[model samples]
Target: MTEETNGAAEPKAAAAPSQPVMQVLAQFVRDLSFENIVAQKGITNAAQPDVQVQVNLDAKKRSVENQYEVIMKLKVVSNIKDTQDPMFLMELEYGGIFHIQNVPDEQMHPFLLIECPRMLFPYVRRIVGDVTRDGGFPPLNLETIDFLALYRSELQRRAQAEAAAQTTPAS
Candidate 1:
């Protein structure tokens, strides 16, 4: 009798499966400040306002097992397009607590920074819109942020800064 046989080495597809788990425990606004500069200064302009937005992210492990906290910081500023008169300024910091499991150690940072904040963005977006509308301006709808790109930019920035620091002579 003849028997067909496959290779002795196990195929990679047959290896152990990896299933990462993530859950958002809680989310809230950590800090917020809004200034209606146009209203305060009694400035009026027909031109549309130019808006600038900045975002930063932070994450830390909690004492509880499989728990972590992630914070998203945003700063938004607006000005009259033609006259450059200040319109408004808003700074907000939103945070979330998460329970994560099964993610490898090497992947934890990206998972925390990217996925957690993505989950929190909608609520933060609503708060910003409400604040802007209530402050007497049109509701501000923020564009979707690409967290992966942001993460890569941060890494490149850090690497560049580290390289520059290494080359600079001590004062």
Candidate 2:
């Protein structure tokens, strides 16, 4: 590389684009409940039970700039596979405080609801397993969740509801 007679060498290349940043400021269980129906009713299990899980998510911006709180609510119900008798029920509200930066404004909603919960899933799973085992049943390991699909499904549900309302005749 050649330098000008009275000048220094060329300057360095432009820097790469900045990547988004996310940090978990804190994580905790906002609320938890477990009901052991089988134990309460004094029933014995003779076969494997059927289990179903449902999840809901919510996020809000905090008073502090760039900080947000995200909550994941989960409900698990287990019943006798054949008899359909209630076995146990569990509900947990887990939350995380996050500090996020560099994410585009248009993407913030998806980022908070999807990525934040994904980061907190491991802890939530551990809590569920422990609660089930301590409540007198084998530990239940949760299956991996698809946050992207969940987000899409929620959007579709809202759109359908809005369309239905628009089509409904005024009473």
Q: Over the stretch 15-68, how does candidate 1's per-residue lDDT look in tens digits?
A: 576699899999989999999998788776345999999999999999999999
TM-scores for the candidates: 0.88, 0.93
Every candidate's lDDT: 0.93, 0.96
Task: Highest lDDT: give the candidate number.
Answer: 2
| Tens-digit lDDT string for candidate 2 (75-115) | 99999999899999999999999999999999999999899
Residue 133's C-alpha lDDT in candidate 2?
94
Count clashing residue pairs in model 2: 0
Please report how far candidate 2 places residue 153 from its true position, in Å: 0.6
Give per-candidate clash totals.
Answer: 0, 0
